[model samples]
Target: MTREINPFGLRMPPELRELLKREARLNGRSLNAELVARLRTGSDPPDANDPPPRGMRLRTTAVQPRNGWVPTDAERAMLTVFRKLPPEKQLALLTLFE
Candidate 1:
């Protein structure tokens, strides 16, 4: 089945356009697809390479822990679960972020 297309024009500051363009490139999406996806989600985009391919290059990025860093709610929740894992499992899981 073919979905009908709706054409719309948008106007925004040059900076915002650049942000969207960069996000689109990083996400491996066309600008229109990126915009539509964000609008549908009704939330901000994730970090520049958050999940790796779509955000951060996880395995390659350095861990630059801030001087007084704190985990976000999601990170805290993950830590709560991590604390329950057996020693072997904890080490295995940490390998992914290594």
Candidate 2:
């Protein structure tokens, strides 16, 4: 089945457009096709190995405790729950919480 699309204009850097075009070719899809898939899936932007117009990579850094940091009421409740968990589970939870 075919989908109907309306043409639209967007303004971006010329370099970015060129990159998208390169990427579209590498993926064996037209620029419009790649754009449609990206919009439909709501996936993260392409990586460096992907065609050039890749946006920035998603960044996540582990939380670190600061000096004199104090846990709030919510955190205390979470800590109580953590206590109920086994040691291995506690470590895993800490990894996410820390």
| Model 1 misplaced stretches (Cα beyond 4 Å) | 1-3, 43-98
Q: What are the TM-scores, per candidate, against the unseen true structure?
A: 0.43, 0.39
Model number with the top lDDT: 1
lDDT string for model 1 (6-57, tens) is 6788999999888778767766788888887767654654443334333222
Query: What overall lDDT goes with each candidate model?
Result: 0.62, 0.56
* Candidate 2: residue 2 lDDT (0-100): 48
TM-score of model 1 relative to the true fold? Answer: 0.43
Model 2, range 28-97, lDDT digits (tens) per residue? 6798887776675466643323322223122233334445465599966864675577544644554575
Best by TM-score: 1
Q: List the residue pairs that clash in candidate 2.
A: 23-51
